[model samples]
Every structure is written in structure tokens, then in C-alpha cells.
Target: MHQLVATPFGGRGLILRPGSTKAVQLPLARFEELRALASALSTVPQWLIGPVRAQWNVDLTSRSVGDAILVREAGPYEFSRATWEINLGCDLDCSICYLGEKKFEGLDMDGKRKLLAVMRDAGVIWLQITGGEPLIDRDFPESYQIAHEMGMLLELLSNGSRLRKPHILNLLRTFPPAKLTLSVYGATAETYDTVTRRRGGFDRFREGLEQAVDAGLNIDLSLIIVQENAHEVEAMRDWARQLGVPYREYANISPTIHGTAEPLPSQSPQYLTNRAPFTGCPAGVTFFHADPFGRASICKVGREPNIDLIAEGVEGLTRLGGIAESLMLRTGGCSGCKLSDSCRVCRPMAKVFQEAKAPLVNYCQHGMR
Candidate 1:
């Protein structure tokens, strides 16, 4: 049996056996049996028989740590999951950008180690690097290299403003295409500038996209829907279609956790009303978010640490009531709602419990009537 050790960020994971260790995809594609295996072996008491067990070595080196203690809590990956934040810093001053006020400690190389360790330990196969704009970071490439080295899939979420630079374009060509995701704010300069609040942003974004496309890089586009650009969604979709890539709109949510000074005015009714049926939020389940400081928790938007990535490890994450129970305790308004399938509240709503000193809320889900 292989032992699993967790890395720093609750992402990245590694599996270790007697003489060999290698990276394993995370969230463990076949986790149901893992627990049973652990249970079956638990009776043997690892300390009493660990050395004997070492004779049956396998080759899997986890990214988190060197050979040390046996870690039983690890998982492999589930492709549907992806992390979308690279750094908190961004150049665009869009009115809706919620992370603007938050302070970025500036993730350094060591932090990258923690991040890589976590993702590798978690078996997170794909990481989506995002930020104010990832290209602005001088160490962006270094971070990319680490993910690539760990064999984790990579995707970059950027404003596409830096693509016009030949050097930047050249640098990007070194990576695999299946691992990148880009953000295009608008289909045209007028619309782009309106959303970015920068006069030349549209042209820059377009120029960058052109460069990326020319380089034959794999890219996905994300659009933020707002009053000004709501109508542009179809146009942007058509443009993405022309590029032979997929595009989607994400409603603007406040960046309170990123340390932004003020949350974007609670998402507008229009945006909220149009939300698609909720999938009960996959936080702490298929995917989890970590605070800049390496704290792991149920939701990226929630900010506070419901679970600590560094201390708990993968086993800790599962022991914390598992995802389903944790979601019930951490989420709001799940008491008597028949429309649970349509509710969109996340950890932020958990605040209702925190503020009222209650365990949960009494509200009904959408379509309660």
C-alpha cells in the first residue's frame, strides 16, 4: 500500500512507496476504495510492520516532501476541478474588480514551494493561474515551470494585455497548450475599455489575443457580465467561436477575502436572478480554495479558514465532516428549502450563522413558493 503526504496549499499531492515515489493525480479518481484499503491495513499497525511492508516498494514520488514519515491521507485528481487565482495583484481598475483594495503579500518562490507541494499532494491535475494579470508578475514563468515539472495541467487566466509583447509571446510558447486559459473582457475596444475602465484596454486585449492565437497556444476565455457589457455576451461568444475555443460568462462576485476594501455592491438583482441552477457548490469537494497565506477552507469567497491546509492535510480535509456535511454547516439557508437545487448562496452566506451566533439560517432557497 502507498502512503500519501499533503503539500502546503491543499493542492498538489504525491504518493510514496518503499523505494520509489512519484506524483499522483489528485482527488483520487478512485477514492472510495482508498478508505477501505486503509481500514484493512489499519489493524496491522504501521509502526509494528512498516519496515516489513517496505519490501513491497512501488515507484511514486509525491511533490510535497522528501522521504520521511508515512502519510496516509492523500488523493488523486478530478479533471472538473481547477484553481483560478494566480496572484491578487491586477493592473486593470475595473469598477467591479473586487480585489482592488486587498493587499497582496506577493507570493514568492518559497510560497510557490508550498503551493506546488499542496497541489501535488492533493493530486490537483489542472491549475488555473489568475491575478490582476499574471503576465505582470516577473516570476510568472517560474511558477509555471513548477506546475509543469510536477506534471500538473496548467491554465493561465490573464487579461491578455501583455500578449502583444514579442518576448512575452515567445515565453508562453514553451508551455503546453492544454494548460492555459485566458480572459478577454470584450469583443471590441469600446466595450472592453468600458469594462476595464482603461481607454486602450480593448485594443491591447485584442492584440494580445491575436498574438496568443498566432502562437497556437491553447486558451479559454472568461467574460464578466455587468450592466454595460451584458449585451456583448453573445458577441463575445461568437468571437470565441471564431477562434475555435470555448467561452463563458461569470457573474462578478465581491472579493472580500482577497482583502479588498469594500465588497462590490452585493451582486445585482439582475445578475442574481439570472443565475443558473446551483450545483450545491463544489468547494471542499471536487475543488477547494486556499487563502494567500496557505489557509485552506470551504470557499474561496469565504476568506476565513474553516480548515487549515498546512496542518490538516488531505486526511484532515476529509475528517472535517466530509464535504457534504461541511457544506451544510458552512453554507447558509439549507434548512427547509425544497429549491436547494437552485440556491446560489455560498460560504459568504455562512456569515449569517457567524453573525447571529447560530448554526444556520432559516431562509428558504430560491423558488421556495
Candidate 2:
């Protein structure tokens, strides 16, 4: 497992450690020095070592410099981040899951390896490994290990269903993610199980969270507020606070990637949170999302025009910038709206809501206000 990573991103150098969000800026001179000592585990001078230890308590004493400390050369692609959905298969069947069908399908081990290589070569410095539940995938461990080996900072998104398992816990302990985010449906068993529509789900979730916390893994909680569990939102917030991990609340539910309205009924309209106005986003420009089959899209929410990274390879990404611009054009149902300047949702999101025939209040400022 790599203890620390040193890489160039966005015209600057960064030194990052596993299981920690703190990053140390690597000077051009020091960064080039490590690049020169490519084959040898040379001694790290005190000038550089002192601050790293202070920030993350990582000692460079016995660790290999050239090997343990992964040093990656800057790549041609300007992309510094990506999100990959390993598989849509999830353990629980939640009523409001954005991934409507939650089908269990994806690439084989070889294809997955190829996709990760493409991400690395494209300069994806920060990667989020997610799924309906990524832990359930058989190839997840190896895929994660491979990405970590290639010097990408990893973050995981899961439902906390399998975090208690010895195998999953041990794997995480060995090669820690920079952050692990889990979705919290409710604070108690009855509300939790009702929302998930699965028996004993709350018990399993609590156990998993306990084990993960005990293992000292970096964790973030996502408080999911839906109609089934809306009454328990405060209880959920209190539980997350007591657990002492960082958390954020989400009340807005959306249509599926295919623009279906199945998940809309699960939303609690009265409990919805206010949304900020839509602004320009750097989706295809700086970051992209890869689905299970390795098709790269501008982002998860904007999926229509995508690149087949598997068939065309990294060079195909060049077309995405134009695709993003075309997709962002406000010429659909939103074309001449007087409030288009302050609309809360982006074009891709509004298009899906329109497809789902959702109530305008859900996304349009005209109805909402």
C-alpha cells in the first residue's frame, strides 16, 4: 500500500497521504528532486520530512522514497478528478434511489483495469469510487488497489451495509481511502427499514458504522431525507452529530439517469431544502464521470453525449468539451424564461425533470417561488 503520494496537477505539485485530507504543497525544486531519484529509495532530507510528519504524522524514516512514496509525472490531460460507478448492484432496495433499476451489470476485471489505466493516464488525481454499493462488487478490492497503486487519491461512496464485514474492514484498513461517505436514511430501525424496504437494514448499518469508526477510517455521513423518513430528519441529524463525523443533508430527489419519474414519489416536498441558483460548472472541462461500462460523460447528471473510453481511449475525451457546451445551451423549455438568469437547476437536470413530467416546482423557479 502506498503511504504517501507526490504528483503534479493543474500546473502545481502536491504531496498527499492516504486516510487524510490535508495536502502539503511540494515546491518545484523538491518535486523535481524526487523525480530525479526515480529508481532509488533515497533518504528524504529533513527540510521536506519535518512538515509532512507535522501535518499527517507520516514518518519517512523507514518508508521507501522511490517505491513507497509514489511519484507520478504530469500527464497531457488537464483533468484532475473523476467519479466511477463500479456497479449499480446494491444490497438494499431504497424507494428513492436515483439509480432506478439498480441492475447488477458492469465490466469484467480486464475491462475495469483498462478503464483505471485510462483514468490515470488522463491525469485524474482525485477519484471517487462509488456504486449502488461499491463494496458488493467482486472486483472492487482489486480495482481499488490498482487505482491506489497508480497514485490516485480515492474516496468511496457506500450505503454502510457491508462496512462491518471483516473482509471489507480489513481491506480498508490495509489501504485506506482518503474519505468514505455513507448514506444515512434514518436514525432508528423502524424508520430506516421502512425507507429501505429491507428487513434488518438498520441493524446492519449501525453495526457497519460502528466497526468502521472503530477501525479509525476517515468517514463522512450523508443524511438522506425522503418522504418515508422525513419525520426522523432531526433524529438522524442528532445521531450523525453524536457519531462525530462530518455530514450534510440532502432532500432533493431526482429522476433516474434515463429520465424516469419512478423516484419522484419518494420525495418529501414539504421538507425540501432551498437550492442555490445554477451557475457554470466545470464538468467535462475539469472532471468527468465513468459508468460501469467505462463510458465517460461530462458528469453523472449529464450523461447523453459520452465518450467510449474503452474503444477510443483517452484521446476521445477531446470531444467532451464541445459536448458539454452544447448540452449547457439554454434553448429547451428554459429558453426564454424571464427567470432563466436565476434558475436554480442546470440545463441537464431541468431536461430530465421535464422528461419525467415532474411538477415544475421541483426544479423551476417559476413554480417554486
Candidate 3:
């Protein structure tokens, strides 16, 4: 695994690395040279070490380009980011989970390794490993390590249930992710446990979150503002500020991916925030989501006609852009609706809510206004 990486992003040259937030912009000429050297497995010129040092505060221990730097080859695909659901399993039973069902099933180790390889070839620069709590996946450690080695800037989405484990901590320290996001169900144990329906869930979450903070990992907090935990929203924000970690609030809870309204009952009416108006998105164009079984979709909410990556491999991804167009263009109940100019939810999300027979006010502008 290379210690540094040089790749093209949005027509610009970027130099980044694992375990650090700093990135250096490279001139096109220099970026091409580095990319060539990486492809050739050649030694890096003596000059690169100086800039790397100045930018990232690290000294290259090796001169070999393949060892000290991973020059990402420009791929035919335009994808720059992706999120994989390692597994749908979870140790907690949060009432507001969007995945709908939490089955502990996904690609096996060999299949997982293949999937990561495909992502690297497809030009994924930023990869988010999410789940019903990804850290609890049996293959997460090894899969995470392999992805880091392959030069994708990794991000993790979890519930802070397993971050305190020594092996997990050591693995993270060794190949740190670009960001580690944990969702705060509640600030107090009683409310938190009640939200998760898991005894001792709050204590475990606190333990793991504190350990992550102590490790100096790049951390973010997702304050889940649902009915069960809305009372603790302020306390959660204060705690996050006290810890000095970045925090964002997600006050909207929608129907599950399966188009089930089971999770909507937990929505806190007073806490519901207005969503920005529906606009264009780049879901299948530059980004996509992969479920536990390696079914690729434009996004989590639009799972139909998914490509089975394990069976068809990376070549199957070529059809996704067209699929994106087909799905995004179908406005469902909002088709030709004059209120669409003010509607916040997108076509896929609107479809899910419609399938669940959700109250119009929950997602439609007609009721919202």
C-alpha cells in the first residue's frame, strides 16, 4: 500500500493520503508525471518528498513510486464517490433506521475483495462504508484495511457501538479514515436506550465515542432528532461542542427503503425541518450506493433494477447512468404537478413515500404548504 496518492478529480490534480486531512493541488504536468510513475511502479523523483513533507508533515520512507505513492489511473467511468453497505446487521434496534430490515448478509470475504477492486478501477476517490452499523460486520476490519491500501479516502458511518474495541481502534489508527461519523440517538442513557430498544446501548455508545475522540480520529456527530430522542437534542449538541467535534442534525425521518411506513411513527413533529427544494442531483452519474449483497443502485432510496455487481462485475456499471435518467425522470405523483417548484423530496424519495401511502404532508408540497 502506498503512503500517498495522486489522482485527477473534476479535471484537477489532487494529492492526498490516508490518515491525514491535508491535500496538495498539483499542476497538470506534475500530476501526469506522477501518474505515469505510479503506473510504471517506478521510483519517485527526489523532488516530490519536499512538497509532501511541506503539505502533509510526513517524510516518504521509500523512493519507489508504487511504495511511497499510489498514482490513481484515470478510469473510463466518471464516478468519484460511492457508499457500500457492508452488512445490514446491527447490535442496536433503533426505531428510526432507514434500511427497513437489518439482515446480517452481504458479500463474503472474496466477494468483498472483488467489489473493492472494482471500485478502485471505477475511479472512486471517496468511499463511505455504512450499514446498520458497519463496524459490527465480521469482515469490516479486513475490508477496510484493503480499501485503505487501495488508495480510496475512506469514511465510516456507524452508531458508535464498536469503536472502543482495541483491535478496531488499532486498525483505525493504522489506516485512519477521512471521516468517522457516529449517530447520537439520545444524550441520556434512559432516552438513548429507549430509542435503541437495547439495554445498555447508551453506555456502549458513550464508551466507544469517547475512545474515538481520544484517538484523535476525524469525527462527526449525527444528532438523530426523532421523537424518542428529540428531548435530548440540545444536550447532544452541547456535548458535541464540549468535545469540539463537528455535528449535524438530521430531523427528518422517512419511509424505509422497502417503502414501508414502519419508521415514520417515530418522527418528532416539532423537530421536523424543512428540506431544500427538489433540484438536480448526481446520484448515478458521479456517485452510487451498494447494498449488502452488492446490488448497485442510483441511491439507497432508488433500489429497483439494480445491477448485481458480484455477478456482472464492474462492466455492469456502464448502464447505471442511463438507469439514473430513467428513474430520475419519472416524477410519479409529482409529474407535471405545479407545486413541484416548492417540493423538497426528489422523485425516488417521493416514490418510496407514495408506495408506503404516507401522509401527503410528510413529503408532498400540497400538504406541506
TM-score of each: 0.64, 0.96, 0.95
Per-residue lDDT tens digits for candidate 3, residues 1-369, read: 678878888777888988666798877888888777777877777677888888877787467887788778776789989999999999998877887778898789999998898888889989999998899988999999999988899999999889889999889988989999899989999999999999998999999999999999999999998888887889999999999999999988989988999999999999887788988788999998998888899998888879988888778899999888998765667778877666788889999999889998898768855
* TM-score for predicted model 2 compared with the true structure: 0.96
For each candidate, the alpha-carbon lDDT, in order, equals 0.56, 0.88, 0.87
Point out where model 2 deviates above 4 Å: 62-64
In lDDT terms, how accurate is model 1?
0.56
| lDDT by residue for model 2 (64-113), tens | 57755788877677788899999999999987888889898999999999
Positional deviation of residue 164's Cα in model 2 after best superposition, in angstroms: 1.3
| Candidate 2 residue pairs that clash | none
Error of 2 at 76 (Å): 0.9
Off by over 4 Å in 3: 38-47
Error of 2 at 322 (Å): 1.0
Ranking by TM-score: 2, 3, 1
Q: What local lDDT does model 1 show for residue 325? A: 48
* Model 3 residue 257 lDDT score: 89
